[model samples]
Each structure stands twice: as C-alpha cells, then as structure tokens.
Target: MKIRSVLSAAVLAVAATFTSAQAFAQDTFTLKMAETWGPNFPIFGDTTKNFAKSVETMSNGRLKIRIDSANKHKAPLGVFDMVKAGQYDMGHSASYYWKGKVPETLFFTSMPFGMNAMEQYAWFYHGGGMELMQEVYGAHNMLSFPGGNTGVQMGGWFREEIKSLDDLKGLKMRIPGFAGEVFAEVGVNPTNIAPGELYTALERNTIDAVEWVGPALDLRLGFQQIADYYYTGWHEPATELQFLINKKVWEKLPADLKEILRVAMRTASYDMLVLSQHANAEAWANIKKDYPNVQIKQFPQDIFQAMYDANKKLLKEASASNEQAARIVKSQQDYLAQSRAYTDISERAYLNTMGTVE
Candidate 1:
C-alpha cells in the first residue's frame, strides 16, 4: 500500500509539470496595428493585409496582427505619434509623413530624383539604409522597417503643360514631403491636402496640380477626368512606406516571433513593389484606351535642371543641420551613384535598345 501511494504521488507530479510545459509552449501573442490608409485602399491596404496573413501563417497562430485602418482609428496622419506612444504596437505609414515632428524621418522615404525601386531596396538591405533609418526612429522609441514601395511615382497631374521653370512659379500644387519642399524652392506653392479632397480641390481649381501615387492609386482618385497633362516622374523615384513598431513592444516579442515579423514585413514590402508594377501597367493601358483627353508629358530640360539643383541645395541644408542626417545623405548619395552606374549600363541600355526595336 505504501509503495502504490508513492508511485501515484510521483505520477501526479509529473503530469502537472507536463501540463505547465504544454501551456508555455502554446503561448500566443497578438499585436494591434494602425495604418495610415483608409479601409480597403487598394495596394497600400493590401500590403498590410498580406503582412498580417503572413505573420499568422508563419507563426502557426502563435503570433497575430490585428490591423485598424484610418477609418477605424480616425487618425491617418497620427500613426507615428500613436505607435511611439504605445497606443498601437505597430503602424503602417510613410516616414516622410512625420518629418515635421522628426526631421530625420524625411530621408527614409524617397528623395527628389533619388534611387529607383530596385536600387532603393538594395540600399535598404545592403547599403546601411536600414541601420540609418533605425537610428532616426530609435530616438522616438520606435523601430522603422520598409513597409512597401510605390515604385517611380508620376510627377503629377497638371491642368496645363509645364513649358519651363516659369510655369512652376506661383503654381499651387498638392504635393507632400521633401518633394514639396523642392517644389517650393522652385517657386511653386506646395500645399498639403487630404487624399479624399484631392479630386475636389483640383476640380474646383483650388490647386493647379496634384502629385499622388502612381497610376494604380492615382487612377482610383479620378485625377484623369480633371487634369489634362500627366507628367513623368522625377521627385520620388522610389517612395518607400514604413512599418513602425514600438520599441517596448518589439523587445517583448520572443526571438522567433520577432524574426517572423521581420520576414513578413520584408516580404510584404517587396510584394507591393511587384504588385505596383503590375497594377500600374494595367492602369496605364486602361487610361490610354479610355481617357483620350489625357496627355503624358515630361518636364522641360531647364525645369528638370532647376529642380535638380534645388533638390541638391535642400539636401545640403538638411545635412548641414544634423550630423546623423549628413551621414544618411552621404550614404544614399554614394550608394545611388554606384548603383545607377550599373543600372544605366544594364537596364537603361536594354530599354533604350528595345525602344528602337519596335
């Protein structure tokens, strides 16, 4: 009887230990995310959805991301502040959107006449861009990762043709970020208008031009109906959106879950670039076929030269003001020069050759 009681007690203790271990093994975590985009906002929205799905799948339900769009949060531009303050565990927005609050945040998004999508992605992964971006966001107790890319955005939708630098003078435009500053330097009056109000503003002649995303997103806003001229891109060759994670939230995540989040964000960012290319191609074809009144135009040589000079000057000023900004700018400039040289020989040469073939 004594031996049987001892064995029973030992077996009960082992079972309790096993149960505790199982519970720990099956522990789960859920992170709430706030996005700058409205509900079901095409490419931008799709990226976040993809990220959430990937995280859940990769973690086998151990980790989950619950996303709230601008409509739910009612604060499209408040992503950075909310994420930094721990109001949200994560956020999806452009880094430049917070430039007013943190000036160094401007450089994470594309600059005027900067690297293209491929070049910029390379820079982020291989050329110290991610480290520099983290340095900027770290001060705010957040971590920033590349959320997505818009590829090379169209310069803008203009009501009339831009003949020269003079055409930019006194031009009221809906442009944002560092690009807006560049335009302001070139004598344009740059204004910030909400995305929902862009069409009305243009239709009412409140703004002479609007610079939004590429064909994929711009078409949805019906800019073609109000604007006659669509200009080629120069300002934002690769506008990279950001994923913000609060440092405390990130630190609390288990190692495996952290890696899962990283991979999910990275993959989603690249996916958006490909998706943008595909969607833009289809949208451009539709616009050409349906919108006969729309004309595609490039800025004149003198205008491009002037804007280029203005961009360089602004960059210098930014770098001069902040030591970290100087390092980031120089890193990007150096990487771009090196990457572009090869791109000019390979992609550019091939495209130029193909242009004459047909």
Candidate 2:
C-alpha cells in the first residue's frame, strides 16, 4: 500500500508538470505594426490587413498583429524609425522612403528601368536580393521582407504633353525615391507631397505633375478628371513595398510563430501583386468609359533615351559612392539583363503574337 501511494504521487506530479509546459508553449503574443498608408487606402492598405489576418489564422490565435495606419501614427514616412526604435514591432512601407536616412535601403525598392515584378521576386527569394536587403536593414535593428509589389507604376499625370525632353525642364512634379532623383537629373524639379494633398496640389497648380501609383490607386485620387496625359511608366518598374520587423521582437518569437509570420508576409506580398493587376485593369476600364479626356501616352523616344541615360549615370554615381550599392546595382543589372532576355522571347513574344492575331 505504501509503494502504490508513492507511485500515484509521482504520476500526479508528472502530469501537472506536463500540463504546465503545454500551457507555456501555447502562450499568445500580440505585435503592433505601423504603416505608411492611410486607413482603408486601397490595395496598399489591404495588404497589411490581409497579412494580419493571415498571421492570426496561421498561428491559430497564438500571434496577433495590430496595425496602425498613418492617420493613427500621424507620421506617414516615419515607419522605419518607429519600428527600429521599437515603438512599433513591425512596419509596412516602401524601403525607398528611407533612402535619405539609409542610402543602401534605396536598392531594396524598385529602380528606374529595373526588372519587373516577376523577375524581381525571383531575384529576391531565389537570388541574393533577400540577403542583401537584410544586410542593409540588419544594422538598423530591423529585418526587412518584401511586403508587396505594384508591378509597373504609371509615370505620372501630366497637365501638359511631353513632346520632347525639353518639356521635362523646370517641371515641378510630386515624385519620390530614386526615380525622383533621376527626374531631377533630367532638369525636372521633383518634390515629395503627402498622398492626401496630391490631388489638391495638382488641381491648384501648386504642382505641375504627380507620379502616384498605377490606375487602381491613381483613380481614387481623381487624377483622370484633373490631368489629361497619363504617361506610361519607365521608373519604378516593380515598386515593392516592405515589411520591417524589429530584430528583438522577431527573435523573441517562437520558431513556429516566426515561420507563420514570414510565410504570411510572403503570401500577402504575392497576393498584392495579383490584386494590383486585377484592380488596375478594372480601374483602367472605368477610366476609359467615364473619363474620355484621359489619354494614355508614352514618352517620346528622345525623352526615354535621355532619361535612360540619366538613370545609368545616376546609378553609376550611386554605385561609386558605396561598395554595397555597387554590388546591389551590379546584381540587379546582371539579373535584369539575363531575365529580360528570356522574358522577351517568351512572355513578350506571346503577347506580341496575340496582338497580331487580334
């Protein structure tokens, strides 16, 4: 009887220990995220919300992401600082926005005449883009991942037709990032304006042109009614937004939770690209029907040639300044050259064939 009682006590203690351990493993965590976009701001905003939902679901409620849009944070462009300082655990914004603070960051976002969405994603995951991005962000105490891609952005809404390269001179435009620098090189005065004020600025003639995202997002700003010329894009061929996580916060997460967050972010990024395509197509169709005055135009050969040259010169200068920038630029140029060759022969060729048939 004494032996049986001792065995029973040992079994009870083991059961209690096991139960405690199981409860600890199921501990829940909630993270705060800051975004550059306004609340409910079309595709960009949706991406964050979708990511949050995905993380919650994949983690089975063990992890939750609370998002604060620009309105809540009151600092649209301060996402990087907020996340890095641990004011927010994560951030959603374009990496290029921090170029002034971190020059190497500019390479993570799209480049002028760079690879399109598909090729860039390939470079990111399969190639060394992710590793390079980490090297840039790791110093800031943050980890960066691709948040979303806007495929190829439209150039901008111009009030006047760009007949030649001369038209770009002295033109004040709301353009941002590396492309803005390229525009400046070509004699255009590039300025950064808040998205909320872009329409008013353009309408009031405070700005001569605005280079927002493509049709889906630009339509919301009513640019079609205000500006006639919707020029095609050469800059920001694949404007990829970023998901930035504070390194400490990320490290604190359990391995399972970490994977859930990573997968959620990646899935959300790809989803945004698909959503951009669908939404842009629908928005373009609507513009064609409702706004007949909005004419789609491409920059003339001379203007493109000059801007392309300017882009190369600017990239060369950027590379010369930093060794990392030089490596990133070379990697992109090399990948683009190789990828585009195959793309031209396959995707472009098929599209060209279809156009001829139709």
Candidate 3:
C-alpha cells in the first residue's frame, strides 16, 4: 500500500512541472523605446510614437512598447550608448548626432550631396544599402532601421543671401554632423547649438544663420520672424532618421517580433515622408501670406555647382584614411549611380515638365 501511494504522488508532481513549463512559454513580453527628440514633434517624435502604437496593435497584447523621449530617463546625447549597452531596448535619433563616435555613421543618415529621401528609401530597403548599414552598426553592438527622412530641407535661414562661395567665409552657421565639416572646409564657422537655444542665438546675432528643417517646422518655430532670407537649395539634401536597437535585445527577440519591428519601421518611415511633404507645402503657402518680408530664393546654379564639386572632393579626402568610410563612399556612389538613372528618367523628368506646380 505504501509503495503504490508514493508512485502516485511522483506521477502528479511530474504533470504539474510540465504544466508550469507550458505556461511560462506562452507568456508575453515588452519592448522599451527611447529617443533624442522632444515628445510630439512632428516628423521626429510622432513617428516613434506611431511605431510604438503599431507594434502593440500588431502583436495583439503579446508585446507592448514604452517610449521615453529625450531627457526622460537619460540624456538625449547618450541615447546611442544607452541603447548599445542594453540600458534601453530601442532609440530614435538622427544619424548625424554620433559623428564623433562613428564617423561613417553619417553616410547612413545623409551625404553632402547624397540621394533624396525617396531615392535613399529605395537604396536602403531594396538597394543593398541596408546590408552595408548593418555591417557598420553591428560593430557598435546595434541594429538599425530607417525610421524617417526629412525629405530635401531648406538651404537654411540667413540674415543675408549667399551669392558667392566667398559669402560663406567667416560666417558662423549653426549646423551639425558631416555637413559641418564640409561647411568648415568652405570657410563657414559651424556651431552646434541645441534646439532650445537656436532661436535666441539667431535673434541676438550670436549665430549668423541657422538651418532647421523645412518651412513647416521652421515657420512653426518662428525662424521666419528672426531671419531675413530663407534659401531653397538644401545642402543637407535628405536627413534620414534612424531607429537603433540594442544588439542583444534585437538578437533575443523571437523571429516574429523581429519581423514586426522591421515592418513597423518601414511603415513609419513612409508615412513620415508623406506627412512632411504635405506639411511643408501648406506651410510654404501660409508663410508667404503671413510673412511678406521673408524672402525665399533658389540657389544660383554656379554656386550650387561649386558646392557640389567641393562636396565630392571633401568626401574623397575624408574617406582616404578610413576603410569603413571608404566602403560607405563606394556603396553610396554605386547606389547613386544605379538610382540616378531611374530618377533622372522618371521623377526628375516629370518635375521638370510640371515646373513646380502649386
């Protein structure tokens, strides 16, 4: 009788252990996101929040994302390091911010005369840019995806027009990233001013000029009131926003979760570009109506060509000593070669025929 009782007890214990294991396997998880921008800033913070929402809905409660904007839990500049160290799961920031850490990270974000937002999307998603991007970021214990792109930005607001390359000489301009290096080469003194202080710097004449986003964001920020001239030929071309995920966190995610993240990022990226396009159009019209003194001018062809040529030379010089930079330059040039053929034939031709309708 005693032996039979002991055998039955052992059988019940084995069944309970199996059930516990099954329950543990079925449990859900959460993802944390961080960003270096303020919350609710259109084209910047909005897309990140959109991503958080989309991931939650797609996962059907199995996964939830908590987004913390700049300075919420850590300093904005530390976002990359924090995410890399696994202090946070993910982050949203401009690729230019980390030029000091990884000089080549700039190519993934923007080039001096690089591809436009649309062409960049094509190159990154379908064109092999994504593969090389992985290689670069992998070195820093990160996984990245295209979060958003600010489509062609304004030439930047200035107290005076830049008629000749000489005009750039000795001018203190507020810009960031690799663009700063190029501007410096052209004789402009580049200064890094936080967003909060940008307006005061321009208003008080502390900085000669500042380049923010397009009219949509610029007008909203009240730069139109402070500066006399707003130029159209954006030197920064297209600013690609990045989503950085901690390498370990990325690797640990189940395959399904990883797929969800990639798809969500792509969706957010597309939506951001579209949003910026419409917003800029409306803002431009409204600005012309409201601010009559704000002179908007296209860059002269001669000046544009000179800057473009200088950009090429600067790129070659910068990459000469750095192999990774060389790889990025090669990839960018190759992708541009392949993409420009189509762009020139289709988009550029159509725009030329239409001649800036609206």
Candidate 4:
C-alpha cells in the first residue's frame, strides 16, 4: 500500500509539471516592429536586428519579433506615429526626431553639450530620466526605452571650412532636435531630412551641410565622397536612440515577455555603443588614409559660445511654455551639474593626461 501511494504521488507531480510547460508553450506571441533605418544599414540597423534576435532567443521561441525597415514601411521618420497608432507594435528610432510634435522628447535624446554616453546612461537609469520619459510617452499612448547610443556625433559635413559665425548664417543644414533650434537661433536654417535623402540632398545642393551621425553611419551613406569638411560634434554628445512600443500592446504582453523585452532592449542599447566605437574607430582610420580631401575641423570658439547661449535661452523658453518641460529641463540640468563634476575630475582628467603621452 505504501509503495503504491508513493508511485501515484510522483506521477501526479510529473503531470502538473507537464501541464505548466504546455501552457507556457501554447502562449507564443509574435510582435511586429518598424525601424527608421533602411535595410541592414550598419550600426543603427544592426541594433534593431540584434534586439529582435535576442528577444526570440531569450524567450526560447515563446516570443518572436519581426522587424520592418524603412524601405518596407516607406516612412523613415514616422516611427513614433506608427507605433503610437498601433500600426506597428514597436519602433526603433531616435527620441529627439519627434521633438517638433513633443518638445519634451528632445531632452530624452542627447542634449547639446550635455552628458556623454556613460553619464547620460546613469542619468536615465539611476536619476529620474526614465520616469520623465515615460511621463512624456505615456501621454502619447506609447512606452519608450533607450534603443541605442552613437556616442558623440560629428557636428556635420560642410562643403567649405567654416571660419566664423558668419559662415553658419543662412546655411541650410540637416540638423534635428533642440540643437536645430539652437542653430536656428544663431541664424542657421536647420531642416530635418530623412536618412535616405541626406546624400542626395547634399549632392544636389538642396542643403548646404548634413549632420547625419558619426563615421560608422556617415561613411556607409558615402557622405565623405561629396563633402569636403567634417566638423567635430558639439550638438549631440550622447545621441541615444529610442525603442518605442504601443502602450496597449505592451499592456497585453505577459509579465515574463515584458521583462524579456526590457532586458533585450537594454542589452541591445549598450551593444550599439560598443559596436559604434569599434566601427567608428576603423572607419576613422580608413578616412585618414583614403579620404584625403576630407578635412576635420572644429567650430570657432565664438560659434560655440553663441550656440551655448542660444541653448540656455531655448531651455528657459521651453520650460516657461510647459510644466512638464519645466520638470524635465530642471531634472536634466540638475543631474548634469551633479554628474559632470565627477566626470571632469575622472574621465576628463584622464583624457587630458593621456593627451600628453608621446
């Protein structure tokens, strides 16, 4: 009697385990994503691909993500809208790109002369940045996560070397976000151009200059062939991209799947920064050897001062306009002030010391 009872209890335990496994297996889901980049467009596109693959792998086929690039979607800049409308379950793009519609979105991306990648990441995860971002996106019926980082972007590709502030005046450049507003304040006509149109726009003289991204992506787009001068970056120091999901779609996801997506997005975002460092370093070396006509330049000190002043002015104006913008701006400013002090003594000091070596 005792042996029979033991065997029956063991069989019941196995049956329960099998039933649980079956339930999980039957709850399979597939999500659709749209990206701003064209198909397989280097680091930016690679971020999305890596993210989708990681989600599927981690979930062990219980969850799958299907990515649609700009080529298929036919809207490179409409990612926020598509995801919000639930036309796509998710979107991979930059947050600042939507600043015209949501002014607070600009702060979530890199601010001009703001924190670097490391500092910005700290602010996002540790500081109040994530909550603030959710507050902004939640209103739009979407959830936003950090998609990727491009480190520091090049200021732009210029046809001719800019000697002074006068050179920037009346110059039509493809620059976006609050940086564009700052540029506009300093007399630059800042315009937002889709990534695919950048080469043609610059080649055809539709725009005088373009600030697409750093070398990894700019090189892929063949910007070096037509533009003679590449300037150092000041506008977008960290340039964190965004992964957006419809709030409704996210709410419908199982808790386990939501956590999986979160982990995948965070890992993918960090990986892009690493990949960018590797690819940009290699591309820079190649540029030096092959692109003889491409001269690297820096904006004059006066130009920097003017734009800095413009940035301050715009921040004040934006804060004055909206309560939420005020909170975000204040939060960012306070965080930057606290974080950058350490950065100056640590990373900046280390870099300065290294500059003297041989």
After superposition, the stretches of candidate 3 with alpha carbons farther than 4 Å from their true spots are 1-25, 356-358
Model 4, residue 193: distance off in Å is 4.2
Taken over the whole model, the C-alpha lDDT of each candidate is 0.93, 0.93, 0.84, 0.91
lDDT of 2: 0.93
Kindly indicate the candidate among 1 and 3 with the higher lDDT.
1
Q: What is the lDDT of residue 161 in candidate 3?
A: 85
lDDT of 4 by residue, 1-358 (tens): 9999999999999999998999965688888999998898888888998889888888988889999998899998899999999999999999988988988898898989888999899999999899999999999999999999999999999987899999999999999767888999999999988777999999999999999888877888888999999999999999899999999999988998999999999999999999999999999889888899999999999999999999999889989979999999888889999999999999999999999998
lDDT of 4: 0.91
Clashing residue pairs for model 4: none
Estimate, for each residue in 17-40, the C-alpha lDDT of model 2 and write its tens digit: 998998889989999999998899
RMSD (Å) per prediction: 1.7, 2.3, 2.9, 4.0
TM-score on alpha carbons, each prediction:
0.96, 0.94, 0.91, 0.90
Give the poorly placed runs of model 2, Cα more than 4 Å off.
1-15
The per-residue C-alpha lDDT of model 1 at residue 329 equals 92
Off by over 4 Å in 1: 1-12
lDDT of 3 at 63: 70
